[model samples]
Target: MVVVFYFAAFFVATEFALVQTRKSALESALEAGKGNRRKLQTALKMVQNLNEYLSTTQVGVTLAGIILGWIGEGTIEILIVDALRIAPISETGLHAIGAILGVMLLTYLEVVLTEIVPKNLSIDMPMKMMMLVVTPLHYFHILFYPFVWLLNVSAAAIIHLFGLRPASESNDVLTQAEILRLSRNAVTGGMLDKNDLLYMQRAFDFNDKIAKDIMVDRTSLEVVDITDSVKTVINYYLRQGFSRFPVVANNDKDKILGYVYIYDLIRQAQVDDRILVSKLLRTIITVPEVTPIQGLLQQMIQKQTPIVVVLDEYGGTSGIVTDKDIYEELFGVVKDEIDNVSSEYILKNADGSYKISGKTTLYDFERFFRTKNKNFDESESVTIAGYLLENYKVKRDDVITIGQFDLKVVDLNHNYIDWLEVRRHAASPDEQNAPQDKPAEINGQK
Candidate 1:
C-alpha cells in the first residue's frame, strides 16, 4: 500500500513540475534583469534543466521503483530464511517488517529522486535546469518516438470504435487575440513587467486597426510636383522631414506617378546637376487607405523595409505612412525631426471653452480636462464628433443633452457639424458605468 502511494506521488510531482517549469523560468529571467542578478539567472537556468529531465526521466523511475519494491519484499523473505537462517518462512511479523522496510525505502527514493530535488530545482534555477536537461530528455523522446506514436494511434482507434469521439488535435489553437490575452495576464500576475505588456498590447491594438486609424489626415500631407527639379524636391524633403515623397503632376495629387525617395533623388542630383523628376523618382509601394495595419506590417517585414504609400479609391496618393508609423503604434508616438512640438490645442477663451475642430473626438476632450462629458452620450459614438451626430435630432448650433452629457454645437458646416464646444452636464449615474469602445490600433499582430 505504501509503495502504491509512493508511485502515485511520483507521477503527480513529475506532471506538476512540467507545467510550472516554462513560465517560472521566464519570470525568473525577466526579474533577474531588474537588479544585479547574475546569480538569479544562473539559478533559474539550473531549475529549467532539472524540469526537462524530470518530465521524461519519470519513465525510468517508475520502472525502477516497481522492481525494487517487488525484489526487496519477495526476495528478502527467502534470503532471511535461507541465507541468514534467522527467520522461519511462516513468521508473519518478519514478513511484515520486510515489506514495511522495503516500502519505506521506496518512498524515500521516490521523494528524493522525483519530488524534493526536482521541485526545489523547479522552484529555483528553472532556466538552468531547462537548458541542462532539455537535450537528454528530447533524446529519450526520440528514442521512444516509434512506440509512443503506435500507442497513440491504437488508443485513438479504440476510442473511435466505441462510437466515441477520439480526442482531436486542431490545426489551429490560439489566435492573435488569445495570445495577447495571455501576454497581458502574464504581466498582471507579476510574471512579466508593465512596459513589456504595454508594448505587446500596443502591438495587438495596431494589428486590429487600419491605415485610416493612425494616418496623418490627407490635409496634413505635403507632396511634390512630379515636374519639379531635383533641387526643388530636395527642399520639400528637407522641410517635410521625410525620406520619401509622393510626386504629383501640377499639384494634382490624384495624378501621382509613383514617388521619389530622397536617397535616389539626392544620388541623381549629384550626377545630373539638372535632374528632372522622371529620371530620379522611385516607384511607390501603394496600399489602400483602409488596409489593416497587420497586412502592412507583413509587407514591411517581407520587404525588410518600413515605408508604404497609402492611396485613395481612385489610386491617388492620399497620404504616406512609414514603418515608423506602425512602430509608433507599438512604442508610442515617435516625433519626426520636423514635428511641431509647440503646435498644441489651447483653450483660447475666458469661458474655459475654445474653438475646436469638428473632427475631434469628445473622448479626447473629456480626458484632456480630466472630467467626464455629462451632456454627450458615448454609447452613440466613439468620438466626441461622432456622439454629436448620432444623438442629436436637431443639427443646429444648440446645446443638447443626452443622459446628462451636454454638448453645444458651436459650429456647423453647410451639411455637417464641422466644429463644436462640448461639456458634460452633471454627475451622471448611467454614463459612469458605460463600457468603453475598443481603441482603434494594434501591433505585432502576426
Candidate 2:
C-alpha cells in the first residue's frame, strides 16, 4: 500500500509541476550561472516535451491503480476476515462483510493519501515538488520507455480517429492581461498587497502611456533668456529654488535653445562673473509629445539626460517630460529636495466632498470617484477640468451639475482651472423615506 501510494503521488506531482511551473522562472534560473544550471536545463527540456511525459504519467497512474486493487484489497480482505472471525455466524456472511470493509478501507486510503495530499502539495510548491519527483519519474520513464511509447502512439491514433489534433505542450508564458488577472486574484487572496498590485498594474500600463499625457503644460514652465547676466540668472535660480531652467533665445520662450543647470551656473560664475547664459547652457534633448514613455525613458538613459522638451506637431515646444514624470506614472510620485510642489491631488473637504486638481487625468478621477461619469465623454478631454471647460465653458465661481455631483470651480489661474470642489446631491427627507424600486445613483453612477 505504501509503494502504491508513492507511485500515485509521483504521477500526480509530475502532472501539476509540469503544468504550473512558469517558463520565465526556468529562464531566469538558467541565466543565473550556478551549479544548478544543468539541473534546471534538464527540467526545462522535460517540461518542453510535456505531452510525451504526461502520457508517461498516465501509464503510471493506471498501473498504480491496478496494483493497489490487486495487492491492497486482497491483503485488507484477509486481515478483515481474521479480525471478524469471532463475530461471524456463517462462512458466506463473513466473506461478504470482509469484502465490503476491505473496499471501504482501500477507498479511504486512496482518496486521502493518493489524491488529496499529493495534489495540494503539488499546487502549493510546484518548483520544490518538481525537483523532488522529476528525477525518480525520469528513471521510471526510462525503465518503461517501451510501454510509454506504445501508450502515446495509441492515444494519438485514438485522437486522430475522433478528427482531433494531437495534444502538445508549450512554454508557460503569460500575457499582460493574464498577469493582471493573476495579480488581481493574488490581491483578493491577500497574497499580494494593494499598493504592490497597483504598482504592477501601472508598470504594465506605463509603456502604453505617452509623454503628453503626463508632462507639465508649457503654461506652467519657467524659462530664462539667454542674454540674462550671470548675476540675474543666479538670482532667478536662487529665488525659484530650481535646479534647472529652460534657456530661450532673444527672450522668446518659443525659441528655446537649451537649458541651464544651477550647478553649472554656480561653477562658471566663480571663474568668470561675465559668463553669458548661453556659454553655461547644456544641450537638451527634444522628443515628440506622442512618444511612448518606454521609448522616452530609453532615449533618456542612452543620452544620460533626465529632462527632455516635448515638441508639438508644428515643431513648437509643448511642454516638458522628465524622468520624474515617467517614474510618477509607473510608481507614483517621487519628490526630490528641490521639488517644492504639493503632492496632494485629492483633498477631502469638511462637508463630505472633495477638491481635485484641474490637471488630474480622467483615469485618476474615475479611481477617486469610484464611478464613471456618463455625462463626460472621454474623447473630448483628458482631464476633468478640461472636460468641464470644453463642454460647459465654466468659469471660476460658477457651479455646474455633472450627473448627481455639483462641481464648483473654487480657484483659477488665469484662464486655466486651478481647483474644483465636488459634492454629491443629497436626497430630500421625503425621497429618502420613500421605497426605491431600483438602486439609487450616487454621484450620477450606480
Candidate 3:
C-alpha cells in the first residue's frame, strides 16, 4: 500500500509540474549550460512530446489506483474488523462499521498524501519538481510506451469524432493576448520593468495602426519647389533643420515630383548655385493612407527608404510618414538636440490643472487621467487635437466641457489647437448649471 501510494503521488506531481513549467525557461537554461545537459535534453524531449508523456502519467496513476483499491482496501478492512472484534456489538453491525471506517481512512490518506500535497508542491516550484522527477518519469514513459500509444490513438479518434483536433506541440505556445497578460503580471510582481512592459504592449499595437495614425499632416510639411535655385534649397534645409524635403512642382504639394537630400543639394550648390532642385531629386515611395504600418515597414525595408509619402483616396498627398514616426509609436518620444529640453506633452500645475500638448495621443491622455470617457471615440481620432476637431469646432480660448473635466484651448496655430489647459471639476448640480462662456459648438452646429 505504501509503495503504491508513492507511485500515485509521483505521477500526480509529474503531471502538474510538466504542465506548469515554461518550455522557454528550460530551453534558455539549456542554452546557458546551467544544468546537466543530458537531463535537460531529456526533459525538453518530454515537454516537446507532452501528450505522450502525459498519457504515461495517466496510465501509471490508473494502475496505482486500481492496485491500491483491490489489495490495500481489503487488507485494511480485515484489520479493522479484527481490531474491533472485541467491541460490544453484533457481528454484522460491527463488520459494517469497520468497512465504513476503512474506506474513510483510505480516502483521507489518498487525497492528502497522493493528490493534494504533491500537486501544490509541484505548482509552487515547477522547475525544481521537473528536475527531480524527469529522469524517473522518462523511464516510466518508455516502460509504458505501448499503453500510452494506445491511449493517445483512442483519444485522438474520439476527438476527431467530435470535429475537434487533438492536442499538439503548438498547444504549449502562448498567444499574443496571453503574453501581454503575463507581461502585466510580471510588472505587478516587480519581475519586469514598466518601460519594457510598455514597449511590449506597443509592439502588439504596432501592427494594428495605419499610416494615417502616425504621419505628419501635409499642412505641416516643408517642401522644396522644383523651380527653386540651389541656394534656395540649401537655405530651406538650414532653416528647417531637416535632412531631406519632398520636391513639389509649381509649389503644389499634390504634384510631388520626388525628394531631394541635403547632401545632394549642398554638393550641387558648391559646383553651381543655379542647379534646379528637380535635377538633384531622388525617387520617393508613396503609400495609401490606410496602409497598415506593419506592411509599410516591410516595404520600407525592402526598398531601403526611410520616408514614404501617404496619399488619400483622391490620389493627393495626405501626409508623410518617416522612420522616426514609427519608432516613436513603438518606443515613445525620443528627444534630440533640436528638441527643447523643457518641452513636455503633459505637465501638472500647482493648482491641479494640467497643461497638455495638442499632439498627445488619446491613449496617453486617458492613462494620465485614469479614466475612460465615453464622450471620446478612439476610432474617430488618435490625438487630442483630432478628437476635438471631430467632435467640436475648437478655436483659441474656447472652453469645452467633457464629462467631469473642462478643456480650454490655450493656443491655436491655424485650425489646429496647439496647447490646452485641462481642469477636473467636481460633479455638483450648481456647478453644472452656473453661467459661463458659451461652450464650443459641437460638430459645427449652433
Candidate 4:
C-alpha cells in the first residue's frame, strides 16, 4: 500500500515535471532578450515541427498519467488485501481514500519540485536554464525528428491548401498601441519615468502630423516682385535678412519664378547690376500649398531645390518655402542669431491684445482662441494681418467678427499691414471670468 502510494505520487510529479520542462524550454528559447539567442534562432526553424510533435507528446504524457494512476490504485488494493490482511471490499475502500490523498500529495509535491521551482529558475537565469536543457531537448528532437518532420510537412500542406503560409522572422513588431502599453507598464515597474513614457507615445503619434501644424504661413515669406527694379530687388534682398527670396513676375505672386539665392543673385548682379528684372528671376519651382509635410520633404530632396514656391491652382502665390521651411519640419521652429526670442505675436502695450506682425496667420489667432481650425490652402491671404486688411471694407481702427473670432486693424501699410492686434470679441467676457489656475495647477502640479 505504501509502495503504491509512493509510486502514484512519483507519477504525478513526473507528469508536472514534463509540463514544466517543456514550458520552460519553449519560453526560454523564444524570449527576445534573455536565454540563448542562438538557440532561439535554431528553435524558430524547428518551432513548426516541434509544435506538432509537442501536441503528440502532451497526449502521451496524459495517457501515461492515467495509466499510472490506475496501476497505482490496483496495486495498492492488492497490497492492502494481502499484506495488511484486510478484506477485498475493505481494501477497495482504503485504496479509494489513498488515491484521493495521493492526488492531493502529488499536487503539492509536483508544484514545488516541478512547476514552481523550475519556472523560477528559468525566469531568473534563462540563459543558464536553456544551456542545461537545450541538449536534452535536442536529443528528444533527434529521437522524434522523423515523426516531427512528417507532421510538419502534413500541417504545412494542409495550411497551404487553405492559402496560408507559415510565419517567418520579422523586424517590425510592437504596434503603436502595444508600445504605449509597454511604456506604461515600464513606468509602473520602475523601468521608465512618466515623462519618458509620454515622450515615447508622442514619438509614435508624430507621423500623423500635418504641414499646417508647423508651417510659417505667407505672413513670414519674403518676396521680390519682378516689377521692382534690379536695384530695388538687390536692396530688398540685402535688407530682408534671409539667404533666399521668391521672385514673382509681377505684384501678381502666382507668377512665381524659382527662388534666387543671395549668392546667385549677388554673383549675377555683380556681372551687371543693371541686369533686367525678367532675366534676374530664376525659373519657378513651386508646390501646391496643400501638399503633405512628408511629400514636400521628399519632393525637396528629389528636386534638389532649397526653395519651393507654394502655389494655388488658380495661379496665386500661397507662400514661399526654403530649406528652412523643410528643416523646421524636423527641428521645431529654429531660433538662431537673428530670430526674435519673444512672442512671434508680441503685444507692445499693457492691453491683453497682441500687436501681431502682418505676417502672423489667422491660424495663430485661432490657436490662441483654443479652437480647432480645419487645415486648408488659400491664395488670397496667408496671415491674420493679410486676412484682416483684405476683409475690412473700411480699414481704420475698425474691428469686425468672422464667425466667433474678431480682428481689429491697429495699423496698415501700402504693401502689407506692418502690425495689428487680434482678439475674440465674443470671448472677452468668458476670458475675464475663466479660472487663472494655469501655471498654478497643471504645469506646476506633481
Index of the highest-TM-score prediction: 3
lDDT of 1 at 305: 51
lDDT of 4 by residue, 1-446 (tens): 34533333333333333333434355654674666676655544433344543534443445445664566545544554455444455756766766666666655654565446655665555445545554445555576667767867787899999998854324225688887897798799897998787666555544665444444456555567766666666676544445556766655556666556667667777677676566655565666767776777788789787666666666566666566655544554555423432375656557666576777665545444445333213437777666655656646577766554555666766746777666655646655564321111111000
True-structure lDDT of candidate 1: 0.60
Separate clash counts for every candidate: 45, 0, 0, 4
Per-residue CA lDDT of model 3 for 1-446, tens digit only, reads: 88999999999999998888878879999999998888888888888888888899999989998998888778888899999988888889877987898889898998999999999999999988999999999889889999889989999999999999998997667889999999999999898998998989899899889999888889888788899988997876654557778889989989888888888888888899897887887888999999999998999999987788999999999988888888888878765433322247988889999899989877667655654655454457988888898889988899998766899999999899889999997856754564332211111000
Candidate 2: residue pairs that collide: none
Tens digit of lDDT per residue, candidate 1, span 262-315? Answer: 888788778874667877666657789899999888887887555566788887
Better of 3 and 4 by TM-score: 3
| Candidate 1 ranges beyond 4 A from true positions | 1-5, 18-158, 161-165, 168-172, 204-214, 227-244, 258-282, 290-307, 342-446
Per-residue lDDT of model 2, residues 1-446, tens digit only: 79888888778778888778766667777787643666677778778888877777888888998999999988999899888889835878878988999999999998888888888888898877877777877888898889989888988999999999886664346799998899899899998898998988898889788989888778877789988877788887664556778889876657889888888888888888677888887888999989999999999999988788889999988988777777788777565544422338778888898888888776566545544554454457988888877877777899987655688999977878989988978655654564322211111000
**TM-score for each candidate, following the candidate numbering:** 0.42, 0.62, 0.69, 0.51
Q: Rank the candidates by TM-score, best first.
A: 3, 2, 4, 1
Cα lDDT for residue 263, model 1? 82
Cα-based lDDT at residue 436, candidate 1: 36
Where in model 2 is the C-alpha error above 4 Å? 1-6, 13-44, 78-82, 88-92, 120-132, 154-169, 177-203, 249-253, 267-281, 301-304, 327-332, 341-446
How close to the true structure is residue 445 of candidate 1, measured as C-alpha lDDT? 12
